[model samples]
Target: MKAMRDVWGQALVDQGAKDPRIVVLDGDLANSTKVDKFAKAHPERFFQMGIAEQNMVGVAAGLASIGQVPWTSTFAVFLTHRAADQIRMLVAQTGANVKLAGSYSGLLIGAVGKTHLDVQDIAIMRAMPDMTVLAPGDNTELLAMMEWANAYDGPVYLRLARDPVPDIFGADYTFEVGKVRVLREGAGVALVTTGTQLSRVVEAADLLATAGLNPTLVHVPSIKPLDADGLRAAVGGHDLVVTVEEHSVLGGLGGLVAETLTATGPAARIERIGLADTWGESADNAYMLNKHGLSPERIRDRVLTVANQVLASHVG
Candidate 1:
């Protein structure tokens, strides 16, 4: 297991070696975001932008305009909330080749408190017309997605967690934009999620299976431009579709799933498990997850209850 941010830092270094146009900008958080690795390796290509996230984004946009690929690194909350306007106007509007790496996203950054946590980043980025929002499940997937982002000539937002997570994909894994990967195949229930929460969902699926509630597990790495056909097919015959994330249910993965299902045919009952229109508190990883009803045991219990309710409704 490896931290996604560490993988991102190494991937940036590797990409920098191969692509001369690649440059990195940090908002006074090189050490925390793990972009310090790139700064050390390629000091000439690295820019220390201090705590000015907005200025960093603008600088990145300018660099991109000059045929350079610029990656801006900072906490997710600062990048998505503080520099939102600059990202929308300069990067998204112009379709700049700027990559935004939002480290320490979601509610797991306990030491930093809610001020540093960002549960609405997906909503902010996905709502942008030209932005590509991605949240890899693990380090291997993050590396693959970084490669894909490098090749794509547009604005990209990569949401990364703070700590290490179990590897969900192998070294041979290849990332395709706007696609979903089905990890497990079952019936009646579909457990769909994105980001690091996928590891917990996989565990919950195992517990569900033991309880005779075998579910179909789908991992959605690309939030924007979601694979509608793949999602629909994966949960077609399922009675319940549970969309989970380390984000808000409002306009994150859950919102994307709801929008997709409503736009397409074959309607199913959807349950969104995530932050519920509330702020996160500073706590340890286990406490935060259990409090947010995101732990493996909590997720399993909730899914089982919901599955039973669905069955009862069908009987009625």
Candidate 2:
């Protein structure tokens, strides 16, 4: 089972208990998304928007207008694309206190096929004005993100991974919005990762450490309104930077980091380790991950290769 689903459900319940004004809106996927737990507790505040995701956003926006913090839950693809107009007009444009919970982001929604996988939600949401896009690296981060979103005053998009990901950040780790946390420090190569790929990066770091090579591991949970300064600091001492993520290399965290480096005048060698330019069909999660080069072994190999490149440059 997905640990993130349980963490999000618990967080929602906790938020609802603290604030009676908290409401949940589901698009006929309450049970699957784990928002049904909140609905069971607060039936009066929960709204079943049916399969109409567009109307779900509208309902969330209206609820937000009335001092209610509404959470809209659905698969990432449907939530971002189906409700694009309502999100842009009612949520982003008006700056509503609505939280869009996009479950099963990237190809993690495997077995559901190409139509369900949402590799482009981040790129789409980040383009919206006044929208805060957050992708938690694990269950711990997801819970912390929920706490942050509840206290925040604007529209937010919370992308969730469906896999049973590793618990990276400890229970006591504090999550600050728009801040990147460096898991390791290294002078050779930096591995920047976000979302589900963070666990793989952690494994890669361990693999490199065992080989007498240290690779900096940076976790970026927030995508939009990113902490460019923090990313720069993490990448400063590294001879090369390698970005790893579950999403596509285009318009994702890797692309954002590249854009940041370009503007900040860091001309260091950079590599993007993410899904290549391709669409996926229906498949299991493991098969989908390996097909896209997102497996832990692949990440370890990529990091080692990048380290070798740095060594060669120094030797020459």
Backbone clash count for every predicted candidate, in the order shown = 0, 0
lDDT of every predicted structure (CA atoms): 0.92, 0.85
Clash pairs, model 1 backbone: none
User: How accurate locally is residue 215 in candidate 1, as Cα lDDT from 0 to 100?
Assistant: 96
**Decoy 1 TM-score against native:** 0.98
Q: What TM-score should be assigned to candidate 2?
A: 0.95
Candidate 1: tens digits of C-alpha lDDT, residues 23-50: 9999999999889999999999999999
What's model 1's lDDT at 296?
92
Off by over 4 Å in 2: none
Cα lDDT of model 2 by residue, 1-316, tens digit:
3578877877898889999989999999888888899988888988898999999999899889989899999999999988999999999999999999999788877787778988888888988999999988888888888889999999999999766888777779888888999888776788898887888778878877887777888988888878898888889867788998887788888889999888867558889987786776688877877777778777777777777877898999
Q: RMSD to the native, candidate 2? A: 1.5
